[model samples]
Target: MSKATVYFGIILLLAVVIYFSLGSNFHNSTTSDLNFGTFSMKIPRYWKKIEFDGIDSYIGGITNETDSLTFDYGWYSYNLSYENREKQLFATDTINGKIALITKPKEVGNGTLGIYIEEAYKKNRFNFLGKNILDEQIVFEIFKSIRFKDSDTTLNSKSFGFTDKITPYSGRSLFYTHCASCHHRNKNLFGPAFASINELDFKKWIIDTTNLGLTGMAKFGIRYHQKAFKKLLMDNDIEKLIEYSKVST
Candidate 1:
């Protein structure tokens, strides 16, 4: 064969080798099925799973040179009122035979989507971060794969427990059910401890500071409501929480 012909054949061989190499990597990448008592999802193999103790949730992610992607599934319950609906994506759809509310991620600004699913008294929120890594379409595909396990066969079969229940009753119970996940009586998990702040400051912190986009706290007021708080706790309960804090500190 002529010199040009030989060079062309060599180039073609290189292209073929590169294609199969990439194909092999893609094929070998494993996908993991994650079962979080409330729901299950299939995650790409590249992502590494991270487990949190004492919390019924799963967080996993993979990072690269240019971008990163993370997935988080946690138990959360909320009633979407008109005001709440306005801030969301203004859309609703069914995933795995359950109605799910779609919310665009305002924090990431990378087109990440959040799927909120409610079943009986159990609710869960799935958050996809890093839109640069996984676009909206891919995110939806991953989210649509989520399946709610049978109620009787869930990981937490013990009455769905505190994470799923919305008991706004005594402040002590309220603290345990909600605040305890991120905070302890005297130590800090995700945020500061209650023992550090006085009762007045603690009440003010929950009512205003917690939702003010503070350094450590996110805006929780948007998801939880005062009406629900009242339904869950009485005036006496609030006082009790304050008194308890004083004694515990």
Candidate 2:
């Protein structure tokens, strides 16, 4: 109860407050914060994006999504099928975060080999007109859209949709059924690299190529692969394609 003791206690309490208030600073920075393109986000400071072999590439930071955090997650990939290389993928997990639920192909090793995207919202909450947020439940939207130059791809081709469930085989089946007629899995037979695309571009690409409900391409996409193309494909699918495109021969 002495004055000296009271003063010391105040100092201790102040220090504690300062430390706790710094909780958020401890937060992990999302990939967007970095300059890395929308393709391989969450890219680390240790790594850099470069045109390695004329394709989207990352070198450094945690590579494998499943592998324990270590050096740069190898290389994250973009669906550039024409570019022949090894298993390059997005290091989804943090150099320090939870173990990613989705484990990539063993060919990709244990690292979070998929692109980490939370679905482009129709309207971002905190960022209403570019605002910020502390409220988790108050959902915002992203009034954003990606359109492609070519008109042969679809949204399904984009990072699978927000949460698609198309497996590799099914995706391939769907692609072959709908895309192979015009495109080739391993070469630029019809269009560009099916792999080099980012999810947003991929989706937009699908819409452009297929023509959804309009004219040109959709005739087949809507006729046969419409249901699965729209439903089964999701953002994760984009992640898969990003990787799949790279392994192409």
Candidate 3:
């Protein structure tokens, strides 16, 4: 072969290799749905799903080389009132038709920042930790793609593990609003399961007016939520909740 023709062929071969390499990288990093039985969310296929055991309140999440998306349960009643609220960046966005509260720290550049989604679904919160705020658009896209299964539908393979399929019942709303974050009907979360709790003790723990000086779990429950329980529950309401739990199963 002529020298010019051989050089041209070498250049063509290198170009083809580079093109395929880039294409493979793009395909491996593309987004896909990550299923969690009751819910599914869109995430980059390159990210690894990590199950957190007990790192503070974090339950589980997915992570990559420098980015992570952790999850935890939170209440809507906890309002945002930080001391340096003026310095930080806060914005409201919509997720699946629900309002989501987004917050970030007072960092200038894209360096070791995080996104906190405290409110949107009233029941759960998501934290996206990373180094670049500019790349946060992916997290918002993932959040927007989250879809929850219908209450009546039966879960396959993996499920939320609520007892008896956890089909909708009279006490469901109350449980979801007040107790679901930390307590489940059958599984233990931050607190003991409803099925494992004593009715009388549970009532006493809720109505903690006289148990201010107690210790252990009772004290922790009463002291931490003294104001909340006082504002949320009355004698009649507590009775109704107790009755609901008994028949919910």
Query: Which model scores highest in TM-score?
Result: 3
Q: After superposition, how far is residue 208 of candidate 3 from its true place, in Å?
A: 41
RMSD value for candidate 2:
16.8
Best by lDDT: 3
lDDT of 1 by residue, 115-146 (tens): 45544224555544454333555455565666
What stretches of model 3 exceed 4 Å from their correct place? Answer: 1-25, 53-58, 74-80, 106-137, 150-249
Model 3 clashing-pair count: 1
Report the lDDT tens digits of candidate 3 across residue range 1-249: 999999999999999999999999898779877876545678887777777664444356777767676655334322334314544455443334333344544554344333344432436554544444456656656655655443212211121121212122224444554565567777788887777777777666777568556453564475566556656666666675677666654
What's the lDDT for residue 198 in model 1?
A: 74
Candidate 2 regions exceeding 4 Å error are 28-32, 35-40, 44-51, 55-166, 169-249
Question: Per-residue lDDT tens digits of candidate 2, residues 1-249?
Answer: 999999999999999998876765554432222222321224333433333332333333322222222211223332222221233222121111111111222242322323222221221101011112222111111111211122122323322222223132334433543455566666676555576545565555443335445543554433344344555466555455556555556
lDDT of each: 0.50, 0.34, 0.55
Cα error of candidate 2 at position 168, Å = 3.9
TM-score of each: 0.39, 0.29, 0.40
Given candidate 2, what's the lDDT at residue 139? Answer: 13
